[model samples]
Target: MNDVRLYSKTDFSKCQLTQHPLYSYIQTFLNHDISCLVENCRNATCYAIEFGKELILVVDAQFQAGQTYPTSLRAQYLDYAQEELALTEIKGQKLLSGAFRLLKTIVPQKIDEAVYVGNYLVSTNLFPNFTLEEVQAIELLLNKHFPNKTIVYRSQNSFLNQELMEHLDVLDYQPFISRQVFIAHQAQVIKRKKSFKKDCKLAKDTMFDIRIDFDVENYTERIIELYSQLYISKYSKINPLYTTVFIEAMTDAQNTQFIGIFDDEKLIGVTMSWSFDGVLTVPILGYDLSYPKEAGIYRLLTYFTLLRVNDEQIFHMSSGVGPFKLSRGAEYFPEYIYYKRVPSAKGYTCSFWLLQKLNKILIRISKKKVF
Candidate 1:
């Protein structure tokens, strides 16, 4: 077998995707089913590199040069918002969510505003760290495929070091922020703090049941209702289309698992998790907002989710809920988003500079205390 192959519906079914890393398997799946979500793209594909049955790197490629810029930006933003944002309150969250929807509707996604070329949605940073040779191979392929267009990458700090940046035209470090992750072996079971412990205890006394399989016939409507309601009120950025596709993907993926938390036979909360490469990731989670906060449904969900995780597997709790995840012994790591444009693309460079300034200003605003 070739060391590197870009699969664009080239008999991928024969290959064992499960043998690859988690992120790679997801990318391969998306490529195989790209028509379901995106359409009429030039070279949308998934790139994979393997050495003697072991996967080295996986890249999700979307060559949208001929496509309109706004559509690509909107799709990218939807993917980002779906993965990153979450909220515990309703009022403020709703306002922010509406504003983002309006912004996406009104603002034109122009070519000049494009920061990535054939973007890697989930960088190798999150999976098994790529070796130096493999990283060089990725750089070469990216350069060949997107010589004029700027290629952007978002990765955890460990992979965004000086050596990698030296090969790129420009590297932009996003505002310093940490994403929380749970390392099972590094984590020791601990009692929740006083208030949280009280809440968990209260929730335990109630008749709450946890179910681990996804039955579309029995759970689809309720799951959609809860997800839609929570996405609007709990996330600042909302993507209706992506949410639909995501729900479909979660239900269809063989390695995926669903955790349904029920209250007296009624579904009150749901979590979508994926198990791969000795790791478990909690990607989608939400509870019915109608439940009073005092009901402690969220606490109950977290408690049981952690209990099901084995000590040998890494639990990717995912981003958001910083204070809560930290309390549960999650280690913190900074994620870096890198941007680069060739010297000829002056328009993009100027746009990126302005964007960097805007990002800094927003960071300052976020740091200020609300009265």
Candidate 2:
């Protein structure tokens, strides 16, 4: 049996995610202004459960409008679906595409109530170790406080043991893959792909300076510029808000690593990576698309990202770009977005029907069968 102690507010600050330099750096880097690492959420309360002194689970009991709801609840999945299908380019049908993007922005404006476990992007493993009893304990605690609301527990790139499989009604989607470039075996890893090999050489031939742990102000406009390109490339509605949040995170030097790629004193690319415990996460990365593709700006940035990871440390490349990631020797794993809710009143069901209609319309517009 595991000895569990519940922690909340300031008490949870001593946990590994915050104590370890890497995790602390990235969380602060990402949530600086949009949210705080150790305070009440914009529309909720933040809490955690610990076993002895090590933190086991962290969650937010959200009850109103907020970033996590509008972004994570749906827009993220839509962005991935669109990217995978390569339908980001808005061409001849300007009015239709414009309306679609507008709907994407409006749909997530309200989330009623929910509990989100793991981090915002759900990139890290929330349960390092698991048991049915422990899961039940946490559920009961949440149920006691917000019995009527929905619970969304996201576990990215982690195993779902038999106990959890049996206990929760899991909603499985497209698998989310986390990429890593382990520096300890860089030589072997690099040889896996001919293109990667070529790209690395191209990167070596190019002249670009990569600086780490810098000021957000120096590259604020550049970051926004590159990110906007990425936003159009991905047809992302979540980009505007995330772009703002990311700028705020880049300012915290203690918890953020801001890598700026410059050519002759002009910024060309930026990769923002955060670390916690021994794990590193590259949540935001952007480069000027106008630059020579052969210059391999992306390849150079990726090469340096791998250099930061060693055998003992893990790197989370977040999600998407399946074949490219696999070619580079990054392992793939399933990430689930679990939803549990008690039977709701008639009005809630009506809202569900309306959401279904919106979902179907989106599917039609994207020409992708999500169901």
Which is the leading candidate under TM-score? 1
User: What TM-score do all the candidates reach, one by one?
Assistant: 0.67, 0.66
lDDT of 2 by residue, 88-202 (tens): 3444345544544654555443343566544444334423444556657666766676677666666533332334554553332122221212112333564566766776676
- The positional error of residue 153 in candidate 2, measured at the CA in angstroms, is 1.8
Candidate 2 Cα deviation (angstroms), residue 320: 2.9
lDDT measured at residue 126 in model 2 versus the true structure, 0 to 100: 28
Q: Kindly give the stretch of ten consecutive residues in candidate 1 with the minimal lDDT sum.
A: 169-178
